[model samples]
Target: MGVVERTWSWLATGAHWSGPDGVWHRLGEHLFLTAVCLAISCAIALPVAVLLGHLGKGGALAVNISNAGRAVPTFAVLVLLLLSPLGTHGSWPTVIALVLFAIPPLLTNAYVGMREVDRDVVEAARGMGMTGRQLIARVELPLAFPLIVTGVRTAAVQVVATTTLAALPGGGGLGRIITAGFRLTDTAQVVAGAVLVAALALLVEGVLMLAERLFDPVRRRTGPVPG
Candidate 1:
């Protein structure tokens, strides 16, 4: 049989979709890891980036540090993390590696977005008696919202793709499917697992793109203003 037909047959097998080791279960684990890592990374990166951007200080240094982090391979980090004390705790190493993988983009985009906000608009807001907090809340964040969301979208897609690596440490995820297939020499199953991950990443990107457009202030303003 052709590779495509074999993969389709594997996917059509009901047993593969129904057990503890099923696609549904693996997908759940993958999603959970993605959500947790993304949330933690965002929580850590965004505030620092925004604060630096607002202060107009240390942003270059911060971005440089994060960029240096990106130069290190995530798998290497995961392996080192797995060798540490945290490895005794289930999933913590995987989570930490993925969070580290996710932080640079979040930090870079948020900092750039905030720094890129129109200075004239900021000065105008300041002239209107806006305090630092008010300016950030009402002006900087809203203006920077699109790029910030873009960073999130980028990070989410990346995390979804990378979470497969979690299976290396016996952390259950779709990567398990691929790794299992490799062990058994089942090419069809490996392909199916890859297809599933790719599909999920595309789905996430599309949803976030729609959300970006919906929340875009410039787009909203350009649309017919409320009568």
Candidate 2:
């Protein structure tokens, strides 16, 4: 049988869809890791980026430091974490590694987005008696929203793809499926696991893109005016 047929047969097996080690369960684990890591990374990166952007000071240094982190491989980080005290605490090492992997883009995009906001607009808001908080809330954030969301979309997709690495440390996720298939020399199962991860990543990208367009203030403002 061809590899495609074999993979299809493997997928069609009902047993694969049921039980604790099933695709459904693995997908849930994968998504849970992705969600937690994404949320934590956002919480850590966005505020710092936005604050630096708002102040228009120290942003370049911060962005450079974050971008430097991108050079380090996440698997290497996970390995180091696994050798540390946190490794014994279930999924904490995996979560921390993934969060580190996710932060650079979030920081870079948000900081760049905020810095990119028009100076004139900021000045006008201030001229209109807007305080620092009001200017950021009403002007900067709204204007920077698209890039910020783009950063989120980028990070989320990256996290979804990278979460597979969690299986290395016995952390649950679709990576388990792939790792198990490797151990058993089951090429079909490995391919199926890869296909699933790729599909999930694409789905996340599409959903976030739709959301970006839906909530885009620029799109809303430039939309057709009533007659």
Candidate 3:
């Protein structure tokens, strides 16, 4: 049979969708890992980027340093961590590696978004007796919402796709499916695993894009005026 037919047959098998080592379980693992890594990355990156951007100080240096992480391979980072004390902690190396991989875009985009908020609008808010905290909460965050969401969308999708690496260290996730297929020399299973990951990444992107449009403060504010 052709590879496509074999792949379709593999996906159609109900047996492959049940049990601990099944597609559902692995997909859940994948999503859970992605969520953990993305949340940790956001917690680490967003505050620092926003604060630096608000102060208009130290943003360039911070962004450059974060971006430098992109130069290093996440797989290599995972390997190094696995060789360290952290290796004993279940999934810590994978989580840390994924978090680092996800941070550069979040930090860079958030900093850029904050800096790009209109200076005149900021000055007007300042002139109107708005405090720094009020300005950030009301003006800056609203305006930067789209770009911030963009960063989140980027990071989430990247994390979803990269979570497959979890299987490398005997971790769970859809990567296990691919690795198992490789071990068994089952090309069909590998293709099905890849397709699942790709589908998940696209789903995440679409959901976030929808959320961005729905909750964008600037779009709501600038919406058509009542007749």
lDDT by residue (22-73, candidate 3, tens digit) is 9999999899999999999999999988888899988767679756976887
| TM-score list, all predictions | 0.95, 0.95, 0.95
* lDDT (C-alpha) at residue 44 in model 3: 96
Name model 2 segments beyond 4 Å from true. 224-227
What are the lDDT scores of the predictions, listed in order?
Answer: 0.90, 0.90, 0.88
Give a tens-digit lDDT track for model 1, residues 128-155.
Answer: 9999999999999989999899999999
The candidates, ranked best first by TM-score, are 2, 1, 3
Positional deviation of residue 76's Cα in model 1 after best superposition, in angstroms: 1.0
Q: Give the TM-score of candidate 3.
A: 0.95
What are the per-residue Cα lDDT tens digits for candidate 2 across 52-165?
Answer: 999998776767876698788888888899999888988999999999888889999999999999999999999999999998899999999999999999999999988998
For candidate 2, the 10 contiguous residues with the lowest summed lDDT are: 218-227
